[model samples]
Target: MTDVEPSTEITGNMQQLIAAKAEELFNLCDTEQKGFIIKKDMQRLRDELGVEPEQLEDVFDSLDIDHNGYLTLEEFTSGFGMFLGDQIDDGNANEQEMIEHNPNDKEEQQLFHDTLEALGAKDLYDDEETIMGLWMKLRENDPVLLRQFEQFIGKITQEIRRSKLDHRSIEAALHSKSSVHESEIKKLYDEMEQQIKAEKAKVLAQEKLKERELREQMDRELRLKEQQLSELTKKQSDLEMKLLRLNLNESETKSENERLQKGLKNLANI
Candidate 1:
């Protein structure tokens, strides 16, 4: 039933009729006066009230909005609004067709009052606003349309629930993948860091080895320089000694030549 706006006007007689039906259904369904009726007990209402089996599910679902499996007077009255205007079938082609219950009929009048007394909706009967409010809650005139609306709402609700579940599943999968990727990235970073440290250590060790080699080479060069200097000093001292011996030999030769010249001059005088 397509829910229409409650813009329809209720004449005084129409008000009385709706009130009577509301009270009747309430009493019939809530016979125990427990203030509510279970889904099973609603079969009486479905059978007697001329509600179709297919439509009943939607009606039950709509009336039992709380999903508590029971119908209060308020819920029952709202359901009554669905079937109030006309007979629940294709036989009555006129949407304007209304059941005219005579207020003057003694049996029907007493039944309406008895229903009110049993259910305590006397205030509802007296107040036009309250009765209209209940009537206005019905959006659709056709039972099939009303049931279709209910089914449509049910489908939409189901879809919403399914979407929420899907969203949660996607979030969980993304979270799992994110966690795995983060772990892999951290492992790779750690391996890279270790490799860098090892390379640095290797390079540092090589540099240190090169420095030691250079130091050893310098020490050897210094020792060779010292040895060459010692040998040159020893050679200079030996050259000085040889020059002194040559000077002494030259002086002795000059003295012997002078002595020989004096001997030759004495022999010429003899």
Candidate 2:
């Protein structure tokens, strides 16, 4: 059987598959529903994937790209791609090389050159200082563009790692002449779909419950307010009645005083 290398499209699909699996593993580890995973969560991954503690620690460190004591989804996905690349290469050679390699190395410089060519900025490649100045300018003036550029570079790097991982698997699948690998891929996707649906349903149910509770509380408050309004109306009516009675009593007393003054005047004339 002829050896076959995976195409770019195939590599992308495999990367997506790996990312999906990583997300699933991340969700499992993050049992508390925190959006990020801490080092403590690595234990869950080790338990589930049956990886060694030391290996898990190494993976966690590599995956936490920002070293912020937590792993975001993007970091986990990209780091897992690299880890799979290492696995495909049959050892920690690639990982060790990455650790030992200098940023100013020829290969790294070549990568920058290729990147500049791809970006149609080859004119800037000859002047490292200019490139640095441009990068700093973007960072300061156009932060969003800088962020997008960083993300694009990260994706390209991740794709390269995934291609290396998929290369051997594609070759093996071609040699075996069996559909087992395809079937496994399908099964994993099906499971992931079901799990995602279940999680969505759970969230919907919680939201509905929250809405119902809020509606009930609002209804109770409305009823209490209505009752208080009714009591206030009654109190106001009682006060108005008391005021009318007081006015009537004052009129009666004034009339009786006027009559006594007239009788006293007649007695004075007699």
Candidate 3:
């Protein structure tokens, strides 16, 4: 017996339920009052929603549509709605109908492939956490899907290699520019250093010239002072000799006057 498909009303109700849940989760995680959730905040969402360790990356990548590592209100609602749809899909419609409804909505699976392609299969294969987390998702096996995955790997590998080459070219160009700038900086520094040294030498020479002139002026002043002292010493010696001659003349005159007084006394006695 074929299972009866659920009505559109049931699906609509389920969608509303999922959207409400998404809103609750968004509000819970958006603590910054911003309208979106960042990668760090996604952890809280993960914990609250009980997202499985395996599907955690897949969930984050899906809701982060623009791949800016954030989820907006609309993106969260839509992506969570798709997740809810997948969980409740068995009662609603067949796989063909699901695809008919929305062909490019391979949210988890597409994100899985893109994530692998972005990291490069070879690089991520050896990574334990990444491989373990995404291993379950890789087990999906539709022959057509498998073929598409293989084709995608080839295409993505070529693109990755081209991107690497371009990156290397850019780095080389930047290194060349940095080297040229370094050389220019060194040249400027050298020029500035030479100018400083020249100015310093000019200042030093001027100081020495000033010092020599000062010394010459001092010598001239010393000679004048010495000559003045010599003239004063000669005048002092002449003054001392005249004072000694005056004292001798005064003593001789006093003796002669005393002898005249004694002779007058003898004449009066006669």
Best by TM-score: 1
Candidate 2 TM-score, C-alpha based: 0.34
lDDT of 3 by residue, 104-134 (tens): 3357546555656665655532222222221
Clashing pairs in 3: none
Q: What is the TM-score ranking, best to worst? A: 1, 3, 2
Please, what are the lDDT tens digits per residue for candidate 2 over residues 130-183?
233233444545665455444444444455557766987888878665577778
Better candidate number, 2 or 3, judged by lDDT: 2
Which candidate gets the maximum lDDT versus the true structure?
2
In candidate 2, stretches whose alpha carbon ends up further than 4 angstroms from where it belongs are 1-178
lDDT of 2 at 125: 25
For model 1, residues 155-183, the per-residue Cα lDDT tens digits are: 43444557778999999999999999999
The global C-alpha lDDT for each of the candidates, from Candidate 1 onward, is: 0.58, 0.64, 0.61
Candidates ranked by lDDT: 2, 3, 1
